[model samples]
Target: MTRNIAMKILLSFLILVAVSACASRQVALVPEDKPFSARKNAEIALLYWIDSLPHVLTTGVDNLIPSPARAAAFQSALEALLRDDPGLAATAAETAGYQVVIFNFGDIRFLALADSRHPGIGPTVIVNPNARRELIAGAPHPVFEEGVDIEAGLFVTRLEARAAIIAGAHACASSVASRCATADNVCPGNGSAPVRVSDAAHNTVLLYQLAHETLAHAWPDSIVFSLRGMMRADNAIVIFSDGSRRHAGVEALPNRLRDGVAATSLSSAGKIVSCQDADDDTLARRSFCGAGNVQGRFLNGSPDACSVDASASSGRFVHLEQGGIVLARLRSAAQLNLSGSAAENLLRGIAAVIPSSEMPMASPDSASGPGQDRR
Candidate 1:
């Protein structure tokens, strides 16, 4: 009996040691708690962006409409996000393409700055295939200060380049004919006051930013117009199949139409950017699906399944956001990884944090109810 007891004790000791060693070796990607600086600086940048610029078109050529009323509404929504999660996150848009210059200059601008720094949301910039001719011509395009490369016409952009676009927009304000002319005034790390940019030029960069970070894939259906999501609800929730609920939203901003069914919801948070078709129709019962956010995927694979391959904090995402005027993403880090693969890390530094694997997700193609938050 004594021999047996001794053997059991030895086994227990070995098991404890093994467990400890494993725990010590597996590096923690996520912060035990959220950091305050990312959120704080981001907020300041947002405030400057909202307050500094003059009215420009948030719609038409781009998603950023310059009406004060629209900007006010955007401000309300973003501020609410900061209130909830300080380390904001990737917006609905994933790819920062040159097409954003025509984004109707809508909501893309504001969301870009909001995502730029906090977690350095994925800022990959690419020129539209069609715009290749123009880029070759160098027709006042949005370029970066440093750390950029062009391969197959795609721009591997960074913050400075993105900011240059914003500053260019400020120069092109409705009042003044300025533009984000140089890598000087607007880009970060230049000792600037962190001022915002113009309507058109900035809107262009914002669209670029959204593609990298802010606004996500424009809802591919006219039903998106009818959904009326986007910052509309302060309390967006994603209920999982396991009966768990989370504060999540979808990026279904209406700009164009594509394949998919409607996943309408009675909840306000699910709605991000609602736009009507030409002679825009609102009386129709057009539903929508989700692209991606903190709780979903970026640029959903099909109209049916919005995927969540990975979830990272912020900089750890690699989504390709199409141009648009609106979006909705996670303030939390894990969900933002939808852009590319949270399969790895979240932060660039030790920030590559992914959220719990078994988190809530919207139904990919659940056309059952009008209230299923399947974005």
Candidate 2:
């Protein structure tokens, strides 16, 4: 009787294992509709910060309206949340009901979201406290920091990058959907995805995302831009052979050129020498317009800028020794919008201008882009 019972138990165990194997095999073969695990993690990370941030910062411009106005502001945020992800909002409220509260700051220079569990806010405008303060103080948004740890930097960089990539993806998918809907054979699927406004805006956001990731990985603490300095020929300098470039901050450029020049690594090359364009101050800094660095000298450009000077060259492939707004600007602009020859040229220029000290001599592709998987 005991032997018969043992045999029956073994048979049942074998059947259970077979069923489990089949389920595992099926799951592995099927593609997920949504990467739920990844999306959930990202959502959690961002929400933690948003929820922790001073309510006024995220609540927007309705606080002035009496109690009625304040309620309206709260409704707006709730409405946006519901419109974007109704199901998620319901789940969040059911699970963790967070409250809205004001943050008392002696001086509200700027405000941003921070993680409630592992908040990474810096008192300084820039992300890195060690960095010079001006680097982040000058920017419209101070979310980007310099020389931050890969794990922390990747968190913010990814949040921004996703916005850009998703915008582009939505545009592409919607365009295809509209065309397909026109044909009766294949009516467009449900409008699960939203449409994006324009390619330019999407591209701009994407470019910023790439730049943010690149700088975070390349020069976590380097100072790239000055906050208030006027950009003069003296402010910009490049050394291709030694690979180092230094330029002025946002305050230097004319308002029109500020976004174009300050937001890129194109200003490191010597001034444009063409006589006709020289009169145009904008043209003078056009040499670095291409992606790669240029080697030469101007009366104002750096002469022997890479001669073992700690100030001129941070002695690191990317000068991240300092942090603050300089690091923020560098981190932000490192990813500029250029293509084919132009992109290569700009990258080459950056490689040449940044001093090579402790980092390996591998090129950008060989070295791996910033915010890469460390594991």
- 116-209 per-residue lDDT for model 1 (tens digits): 2112211222221111111110101122211011111111011111121122222232333223322223323434332233322122233322
TM-score of each: 0.19, 0.20
Whole-model alpha-carbon lDDT for candidate 2: 0.23
Tens-digit lDDT string for candidate 2 (85-174): 323322332222212111111121111211121122111111221111111111112222221222122222321211100111112221
Clashes of each: 72, 34
Best by lDDT: 2
